[model samples]
Structures are given as structure tokens and as C-alpha cells.
Target: MNQNAEYSAVNDAVRGQFLRRTWAMITPYWRSEEKGRAWLLLAALIGLSLFSVAISVWINHWYKDFYNALEKKDTAAFWQLIGYFGAIAAVAILGAVYRLYLTQMLTIRWRAWLTEKHFARWLADKNYYQLEQGGYTDNPDQRISEDLNNFTSNTLGLGLGLLRNIVSLVSFSIILWGVSGSIEVFGFTIPGYMFWCALVYAGIGSWITHLIGRRLIGLSNQQQRFEADLRFSMVRVRENAESIALYNGVPNENQRLSARFGKVWRNFWDIMKVSKRLTFFTAGYEQIAIIFPFIVAAPRYFAGKIELGELMQINSAFGNVQGNFSWFISAYADLASWRATSDRLLSFHQAMSENEQRAPAIDVRPEGERLVVNDLGMDLADGRHLLTDADMTVEPGQRVMLSGRSGSGKSTLLRAMGHLWPAGHGSIRLPAARYLFLPQKPYLPIGTLKAALSYPQADSVYPPERYAQVLETCRLPHLVGRLDEANHWQRMLSPGEQQRLAFARALLFAPQWLYMDEATSAMDEEDEATLYQALIDELPGLSIVSVGHRSSLKRFHGRHVRIEGGRLQEQLVS
Candidate 1:
């Protein structure tokens, strides 16, 4: 096949895949446990939509009688038709209002359910971390937050609008066909001439519309990605504002941010150019449609073959039929946006699925009280060995210190033990008990001190007095009384303070097995020794494994293991 044919085939396949993925994303909600309420609300909303179409048909008929009464100068009939119009208008208005209100309600409920489901899937089995490590998807934060929102809202709005247009098309086409009377063309009757005119007009318009606006889908996708990239950059600046300010790096930061925003600006300009062209055609198409019906039906009216009322009704019915056929043209831009959102969401879901199904190179199982590593080997994502033939074991109550040169996989080994690093071959047997892993830099969620202290656990997990005591034991006595004070703790607290706070968490949770990768590096050796001694005293039988360069950490750990020549070796401590 030619290059263009190949591209077309690929595009068609992508579109088909998108539709199937979209259905998979949407069908679960309707078939879920909440299906009963979801279906009932959907049925009611659809009924309201259909009722509005019925009223439109009634009004189309009313046009004939009302205009005829005016033409005949019949005062009583005119007034009676006016009253009928008022009643029909009232019902139509009510139907429209209720339909919109119910649609919004359903949209929010669907969004909530989908958001929760995405959260569960993304967080399950550490899929979020794995996706980041694998580099399988970009800006998962945007996918979960922005793309999901757009998907739920646009899906409901566009899907229901399509349904309403289909109903209107059926209702109005029947009226138009009956009222338009057959046209005698070359001795053969061309029935439903008005309907045929609407179809042909709209068909040509839709074809041109697709030609003009086909690029918008790809552009919209790029626009969203660029916007998200810029936003993420800004967030990174805000998050590291203190560091940037300390280094006086405003100029460099600004240049980086501007570079990211440049992509957004350029893509938005392209979107604007395409949208302007699309709007020109769509607007002209709509404006001409207003008079097109009258121009087509005027001949019969002037010939006295049809009365003024019938002419007016034909115009109204024709507009409705034509508008139904022109749905794609009117909604082209929003459809592009919807397609882009669906594409991002589906890609994110597929990435998560891939990560979930990935076979781990390292197999971790909970077997006994001792943490064991048998013939452990670590490799980078590119298949470069970081560690080879390393083996070690830590029994209950043993304080083991992992000593290694920088970039010798000390931290990576800790990650492997935690089961977060999978690009390696090993059988690690962990203790069947609670365990905690602390990195060099502690994570303090932007919330209350109590919440941060009890992170990954509810505040109610421990009593207020216990939290205060743990804080005091970790040398953060000043923060004990401010348990409920909410702030960005990571920003407010210094590195040493954050490290101390992590110790407070360890003290609170008191896990049976604790792994620390330079967890106390920011602290003074005196304070680090004090905290380690306190942990050993308070949490009896705690199997503590720590990775650090400071010799001060030696006094805390009873066994010393060093990574030498890519293998683990136990050393006798003096």
C-alpha cells in the first residue's frame, strides 16, 4: 500500500481501538452495583428529552393552525391557538429544565465513581510507582484529575445530545415528508423532496466540515499535553521555591518555565487558526440554513398550492430535520476535545494494566520473622547490573547496617528489599509482620501535624497523647501542642526536622521491621545516635536495617555488611 493508505489504515485502526476502549471504560458503571439508580435516572432523562421533541412536533403542527387563523382573520381561532401555544411552551420549558438538571446530577455521580475507580487502579499493587519507573505514561496526575473529569462530563453531554438529535430527526423527518408533497420530476414523483434536500445539504456540509477540522483532534491532544506540562512545571517551581530562592535561580527557573509554556502557546495558536476556519464554515452553514427552507418551499406558496400556515410549518419542520443532520458539524470542536480526553484516559489505563501484569524479576514473599535475600542480583532498566550475587539475612532484633560507596546500589538494594525495585533477580523472604521503609528525604503531606505524623494511617489510629509523646521522644516537643495546625509541613520543617518527624512516625507505628536509607543523614551524629538508641529501647525485637556512610550509625547497628565488588560481604566490627 501507499504511504497515505498506510497512514489512513493506521488512523482507522486507532479510531476503532479508541471506541472499544471508551466502551470498556464506560460500560462498567452502567453494569456496576449502582446500575439500578444509574439506569433509572438515565431513563427519566431520556424520556424528558423525547418529550421535548414531541412538544417540538406539536408546535410544528400548531404553526399551521395559528398562521392559518391569522391569514383568515379569525380572531377566536387565533386566541385559542395562542392559549394552546402557551400550555405547550410551559411543558416544553419544564422538560428542558428537568433534563438538564438530571444530566448534571448524573454527570457528577458518574465522575465521582470513575474517579474512585481510577484511584483504586492507579494505587493498587503500586502501579503508580511502577508506571513512573517504567516511563510508560506521562503526567498520570493530569490523566486522573483533568482527563477523567473531561471524559465523564463530555461523554454524558455529547452522548445524550446525539440521542436527542436522533429522536428529533425521526420526529421532524416524518412531519416534513408528509407536508412537503411529492415533486413531479421528469414525469416521476420524487417523494419527500424537502427531506431529501435537507439530507443532501447536511451531507455535503458534514463532508466539508470533516475535511476542514480533522486536524483538530490531534491538535487538541497536543494542546492538552502541552498545557499539562506547563502546569506541572509551575507546580515544580512552587514546590521547590525555597531551594530556588536560596540559590537565586529565578532567571534559570523562569527560562525553563517559559520554554514549557512556549509549547502550549504555539499549540494554542494552531488550534485557534483551525477553529476560526471551522467556525466560518459552520456559521455560514447555519445562517444559510435559516433561509434555505423558505427559499426551497417558496415556489409552492407563491403558486397558491400551499397556504401560508403550511409554508411556515414546512420551514419549521425542514429546519429541525436539517439541524438533526448537521449535529456533527455543530459539535465538531467538542467532539475533538472528547476524543482527545478519551485517548489520554485509555492510554493511562493501558499503561496501568501493563504494569499490573508485568512479571517481576525479583520475587518477594513473607515467610518468617527473618528477612532473607538469597542470590540477589540487581539490574537497571537498560539491563546494566548494579549488584550481582548478593546474599544477606537479618534475623529478628538484629540491627544490620548496609555500607556501600555512592552509586553502588545501597539505596537500590533497600528499594529491592521493599519490593519497589523489580528490575532484578532474587528471592527475598520478608518477615510476616509490619514493616516501614524510610528514604533519605521524608515525605510530609500538606496537612495537619497529626496527619503527617500518622501518615498512611488515620489520625484516629493513635490517641492524641501518644502522638504528643512520640513527637517529644523524636525531639519535636515544640510541635506536640500544634497537632491540629495545618500547613505544608515539608516546606515549614527543615531537613533535620523532617527526618526527626519520620522517626516520630516510626516510633508511633513501631513496626517489627524498619529499613532506613540515610534516614538520619540530615541530623547531627549525636541526635542520630540518640534517636537510634531510643528506637532500640522503645521498640524491642525491631529488626533495623540502615544504609548510611556515617560511622556514628555503626554504634546503632550490631552487624555490618558492605557491598564490595558488586557482592555482599559481612565484616567483623572492632
Candidate 2:
């Protein structure tokens, strides 16, 4: 294919794919458990839309009688037609109001359902973590929160508008055809001349609109991505404000943020330029359309072949038909936006599906009360060996210290044991009891202190006193009184405090197995020693597998293992 042909072919394929993906995203809600309510609301809204169109048709006919009354100087007939118009307007107003109200109701309900579904899939099987690690999707948070909103609102709005326009086209086409009458052209009589004129006019206008504005779709997609990236950057800075301030990286961050915004700015300029062109053509097209029908039908009225009322009705019907046929031209911008949103949502869904279906190289199962790793081999996603033929077992009530050189995959091994690492081949027999994995930096959700502490668990899971006592045990007694106070605890607390809070969570849950990957790295040696002693004192039988470089951790664990030459080996405790 030539370049243009190739581009057209690619565009067609993309459009087809977009349609399929859009249907896939949309059909679920309509066929879901709430299908009955959804379908009823849709049917009601569509009925209102059709009723509104029917009222427009009635008003079109009323125009004929009202104008004829004015032409004939009949005050009584004019008054009667005005009363008829008032009734029609009332029904039309009610229909339009209810239609909009129902459309919004449906948008919210669909958005709620889709958001819940996305959240469930995202959280299930640690999909969010896998996606982040694999780098398969970007800004999933934005996709779920912002893109879903746009998808729901724009899809419903554009879809319903198209439907209404189609109905209006059909209704008004019949009126225009009947009123237009036959016309002689080159010794041949042509039917529905007005309808044909409207169709041709709208068709030419739409063609030009698409030709000029097709680039907007890709630009809009880029704009959304740029906006999401900028937003995510700002959020990252806020989340890491302390570190950024400590490093004095404000200028660097500002530069990065500005770069992201620059893409948005440039893309928006392209959109504005295209929009300006589209508006220029569409405005002229619409303005000409206003007078074109009147100009076309004037000869019939002047020649006494048609009454003034008929000519007026013909103008109204022609405008409706032309407007309906020009729906694409009018809605092109929203179409581009909706398509971008759909693409983002569909990409997110596909990434999640791919991640969900991925087979793990490491098989983790619950077999016995002891944690066991048999013939485990760890590799990076790109197949770089992290560990090979590593085997170890942690019997019940054993404290195992996992130590290694700075990049020897100690944390990766810890992640593998938790079944969060996917690029490793292994069989891990876990205890049939609760286990908690605390990384070097504990994750404290932004919420009430109780929620942050009991994280991945409800605040109601434990009694109020237990929270206070656990906080006291973890040396976070200051937080006990603030359990009910809502705040961003992660930002409020220092790293040492955060790690201590993680220990408090461990104390509250009292998991049978606890995996700590440098979980106390943020604390001083003395404070770390104290926390380990507290763990030992508070939870007598907690099988602790800790990954740390500190020799100070040796006293807390009974056995020592080190990663050497990409293999696990027993290490002597000094």
C-alpha cells in the first residue's frame, strides 16, 4: 500500500479495535446483576428522547399552521396554534429534563460499578504490585480514578446523543421529503430534493471536519497521558516531600514537572489549532444551513406553488435533518475525548488481564506448620540470576537471619517467600497461618491511626484496647491516643516511627510467620535491638525470618544464612 493507503488501513484497524474494546468495556454493566435496573433506565431515557423528537415534529407541523394563520391575518387561528405550541413545549421540556437526569443517574451507577470492579481486580493476587514491578502499565491509579470517570460520562453522553440525533434524522427526513415536493432537474423529476440537499450538505461538511481534525484523537490521547504523568509527579513529590526537602531537589522536581506539562501544553496547542479550523468550517456550514433551506424553498412560495406555512415548515424540517446528519461534525471533539478515555481504560484492563493470567515461576503452597523453600532458583524478569538452587527451611518457632551482600537479592528472596516475586522457580511450603512481610519502609495508609495500624485488616478486627496495647508494646504509645484521629500517618511519622508502627501491626495480628526485609533499618542500633527484644518478648513462638546486613540482628535469630555466589549458605554467627 502507498503511504496514505497504509495510514488509512491502520486507522481503520485501530477504529475497529477501539469499537470492540469499547463494547467489551460497556456490555458488562448492561448485562450485569444490575442489568434489570440499567436496562429499565436506558429504555426510559430512550423513550423520553424519542418523545422529544416526536414533539419537535409536532412543532414543525404547528409552524405551518401558525405561519399560515399570520399570512392569512387570522388572529383566532394564530392564538389556537400558540396554545398548541405551549403544550408541545411543556412536554418537550419535561422529556429533556428527565432524559438528562436519568442519563446522569446511569453514568454514576455505571461508574460506581466499574470502579469497584477495577479496584477488586487491581488488588487481587497483588496485581497492582506486579504491574508496577513489570512496568506493563503506567499510572494505573489515574486510569482507575480519572479515566473511568471520563469513560462513563462521555460514553453515555455521546452514545445517547448519537441515538437521539439518529431518531431526529429519521423523523425530520420524512417531514422534509413530504414538504419539499418533487423538483425538475435536466428534464428529470427528482424526489425529496430538500432531504437530498440536507444529506449532501451534512456529508460534505462531515468529510471536511474529519479530514481537518482526525489528528485530534492522537493528540487528545497524548494530552491525557501527559496530564496523568504530571499529576503523578506532583503526587510523588507530595508523598516524598521529606526526602525531597532533605535532598534539596525542588529545582530538579520542578524541571521534571515542567517537562511533563510541556507535553500537555504542546498537545493542547495542536488541539486548539485543529479545533479552530473545525469551528471555522462548522460555524460557516451551520450559518449557511440556516438560510440555504429558505433560499431553496423561496421560489415555490413566490411562484404560488406552496404556501408561506409550508415553506416555513420545510425550513424547520430541513434544519433538523441537516443537524442530525451533521452530528458527527458537531460531536467530533467529544468523540476524540471519549475514544482516548476508552483506549486508556481498555489498555489498563488488558494489562490487568495479562498480569492475572501470567504463570508464576515460583509455586507457593501451604503444606505444614513450618516455612520451607526447596530447590529455589531466583532470576530477574530479564533472566539475570539472583539466586540459584537455594534451599532452606524454617521450622516452627525458629528465628532465621537471612544476610547477604548489598545487591545479592536478600529482599528479592524475602519477596519470593511471600509469593510476590514472579520471576523465580521454586516450591515454598508455607505455614497454614497468617504471615506478615514488612519491608524496610513500612506502608502506612492515609487514614485514622487505627486503620493504618490494622492495615489490610479492618479497624473493627481487634478491640480498642488491643490497638493501644500493641502501640505501647511497639514503643508507639504516642499514637495510641490518636487512633481515632484521621491524618496522613505516613507523612506525619518518621521512618523509625513507621517501622515501629509496622512492629505494632505485627504484634496486633500476631502472625505465626513474620518476614522482615531490613524492617528495622531506619531505627538506631539500640532502638532496633529494643524492638527485636520486644518482638521476642511479646510473641514467643513467632517464626521470624529477617533480611538484614546488621550483625546486631544476629543475637535475635537462632540460625544464620547468607547469599554467596548466587546460592544460599549457612553462616557462622560471630
Candidate 3:
């Protein structure tokens, strides 16, 4: 697509469909098991807001008597009115405090649920890795942490604020209408005098505010993206601080970060310019609004048709009506931010769903108590075939070794078996899906050493003794004692040691089938042979399919499979 066409596509998506789609992302948590808590928080916050509105109305009534007493120069009456005002103020203050507390509580609950849901979907089907592989989801870290937090927080707060404002309008409109009695505007007496004035004033102001602030939505959206990009750059720098320092990359890092932050600077400048213009108009509108009611009621007061008290009461009522109607003005920035957050969350949700629909290469099914690959093929993401015309099988206790030249789809085959290779074509018939794939560089998840070894499984499933035995047998005796130590195990441990831990893990689980991709290559031949022997001795029924390029590995497997020139080399072990 052309640049103009792409811009048009994005513009249309933001305006037309994305917002409606955002609501779908919001419903699951509210309708799920957590619905009771969600509704409870919502009701409590809403009640507080409504109670605040009622307090405002009561104070409006108090305004009339207070001003009447003042106009009469009655000291005692004035003091009595002040006491009444103080009492009403206390309730309003309490209402405001509880309102804030409840809103924050609601925000965290909603954000927690949303964050977890996204985390699961993103990590569940290996969506995080696949999303990156396909270039499907953008800035997943941002989406999960910052964007999810912003989405739930702003959506709940802004949505509730909107609801409260609507209710306030309904409640205050009546009061305003009653205050402004019908009077002759142009030789005809109009019904509900205060209602007509309030309506006209609010309508004109709201239209002008919308017109002035319409550019804010796009600005806000751009600002958020720019900010996220800048923040991501900073986080990258932090993560790679050691490498950058070793290479003396301060100047380069500074330049790169400056470029990223420059986007933030430029976009913020645009927002600032627009904000300056908006502030002038909104501020002027507010200043004039304070006196507008009194101006409309002034003529009646001078005609001796209404007292000073009535004028003051009318002023307060009109202010309430105007306040309720001007919610858009009060929340314009938040609305803009919410729109941007909604756009991000909506895109994330859609990307996850689209990924679920995407076709993957590996087809998993059970076949007669043996792991089998029938016409199995592996391809790169771009449809370039990697492994072609491959076939293999392993029954229980049948240990097999896979050998292939580099770039011969060795790891790709293993990935396919694990159902992580979604880009390739062909079906893999497995004994069961519970099989584990131990990569040459095993993943040490962020937690205890025990948790790292028992990755993709709960630590509670294995006993301490089991964890201890595997660590010792795999030549990871150093880690055996530190099973409870928690850290980023991959970065913390040496490659050889990590590989050792991987084999140690294989010892703990009685996996029906195991796919080891160069899993023992990092270790010495003796250690490798010992670990393989330990597996055979400990779990004789364990079926193993391993990929490695070592002569020593031949003795460990009863069968050998090799791949060359994108096809499996059919040479069996004796």
C-alpha cells in the first residue's frame, strides 16, 4: 500500500471500528468469575459519587438562606448558616475521600485481572514468541505492563466519571429548570426559564470545547506511542548496560536514545501548542460562566421580582447544571488518553485472536503408543522449506539420536515436535503431547533453581529429593544445594552447566518421549554419556529422540537419523 493509503487505513480503523472492538476486551473479566468483585467495587464508587451530587444539591438550597441572612445583616442567622454549611461540607468531604479510595481499588482489581488475562494468552500458546516471529503483536511488554495498566485504570475511572456526570445532569437539570421561571424572551412567555438558559449556555460551550479539542485524540495517541518507544529504548539500554559498557557505547547509546526521545519531544511540543490554545478558550469560558447565571438573573432581581436569596440559589443551581453538562471539558485529556489506551488494548486483543486462527506447521496426534512423524516437513516463517520429506518413530524405551549438518533444520524439527514451529507444513504423530523438548540452551525461568529445572511445570509436582538426585546425576551437584536460590538462571549459569541442568530435569519426569536438540553438545563426552546412561538406568522405559553431532552419542541411541540438504538422511543405528 502507498503511504497515503496506509494513513487512510489507520485513520479509518481508529475512528470507525477499533473503539467498538475495545468493549469486547473489557467484558470477559467483568462477566467472568471476578464479576462479583468488579460489580461490588463499581457500585460502591458510584454510590459515593451520587451521594456527593446530593450533597451539592443540599448545599445549593443552603446557599439561598445563607445569602438571605447575609443581605439582612443578621449576625446570629449568618453564624447559624455557617454551621449548617460546615456540616454539609463535612459530608461532601467524606464522600470525595471514599470516592477516590474506591475508584483506585477498582482500578487495581480491573488492571490485575486484565494483566493476568493478557499474560496467559500471550504466553499460553507460545503467543509471545510466535507474535514476535510473525511480527504480529507490537511492544508486548508495553501492552502487558504499561498499556494494560493504563487501559484498565483510565477506562474504569473515565467510564465511571462519565456515568456520574450523566446522573448528575439528570438530577440537577430539574433544579436548574425550577430556578429559572418562564419569562417573556420576545413577547412570548417561555416555559421553564432556567432550563432554557442552562441548555443554551451548556450546549454552546460543549460544542465549542469539542471543536477546539478535536485534535487532542490523535495527538494523545501519537504521544503515547512515542513515549512507549522511548521508554522501550531506555529499558533496552538498561538490560544491555553491561555489553554497552564493555564496548564503550555511551556515545552511541546516547545518540540512539536521543533519536528515540526526540520523537517524544516533538510530539509533546505539538500537544503543548494545542494545549496552550485550548487553555485560553476553556479558561475564558469558565471565568465568564461564573457570572453568567447572575447576569441572567440580575434583571429579575432589580425588578424586585426575586430576592437576593433567590438570585444566589439560582446561581448555584445553574452552576450545578453547567458543571454536570461540562463533564467533557473536565475530562477532555483523560478521554483522549483513554481513547489511545483503548486503541492499544483493542489492537493487542485482536492480534492475540488472529494468532489463534493462524495455521501452524506441526500436527499432534497419538498413534499406537509410539511417537511418529509422517510426511513431516518444516519451513521457515517466509514459507522457505527447511526440513522436507522427514519420517521417524520411537516406541517406549527406544532411544534414537538425530544427526544433521548445521542449517539442516535440526532445531526446527525439535521445535516442530514441541508444537512451537507454526510456520512449517506437515503433521507429527506423537505418542502424547506431554513430551518435553530440551534445547541445547535450556531456559532458566526467572525463579528458584528448582523452579528453573522444573520449567513449564509446577515445582510442587516434584519432591525435594527428586530435584536433588537429578542435579547430582547430571553433574550439576553445585546447583543441587542451591535449588532454592532464585535468579535468571540462564544468565546466571554457564552454558555447559545450563545444559547439565537440562539433562537433570529430564531425570525428574518420566516423559513418554523426549526431543533433545544438541542438548548434550555443551557438556564433555563423559558427562554427556553419564547423563544419558543415568536416564536409561533410572527410567528404562523412557523413549528418547535426540539431535546431536557427536560419535559418542551413537552408543546412547539404538537408532540414528540424519538430515542433509533439507531432507532426512535415512541411515539407521545398529
lDDT of each: 0.89, 0.88, 0.80
**Model 3 C-alpha lDDT per residue in residues 436-554, reported as the tens digit of each score:** 78887788888998898887788999988999888878887777778898887777777789888887777776676788889987788988889888888887678888888989889
lDDT of 1 by residue, 322-399 (tens): 999999999999999999888777767766776888888899888988989999999987788988977888889899
Look at candidate 3 and give me any clashing residue pairs.
Answer: 180-194
Instruction: Report how far residue 462 has shifted in candidate 3, in Å.
Output: 3.4
lDDT of 1 at 159: 89
Give the residue spans of candidate 1 off by over 4 A.
1-13
Better of 2 and 3 by TM-score: 2
Which model scores highest in TM-score? 1
lDDT of 2 by residue, 1-574 (tens): 2323433444564565778777878999988999999999999988888888888888898989999999999999988888888888888888888988999999899999999999999999999998888776778888899999999999888888899899999889988999899889999998999999999999999999999988888788778877888888899999899899999999999999999899889888988999998889989998999999999888888889999899999999998999999999999999988887777677677778888889988999888898889989999867899999878888999999988899899999888877798987878888888888899998888889999999989999999999999888778877778999999888899989999999888888888889899999999998898789988888888899999988888999999999998999998876
Sliding window of 10 residues with minimal summed lDDT for model 1: 1-10
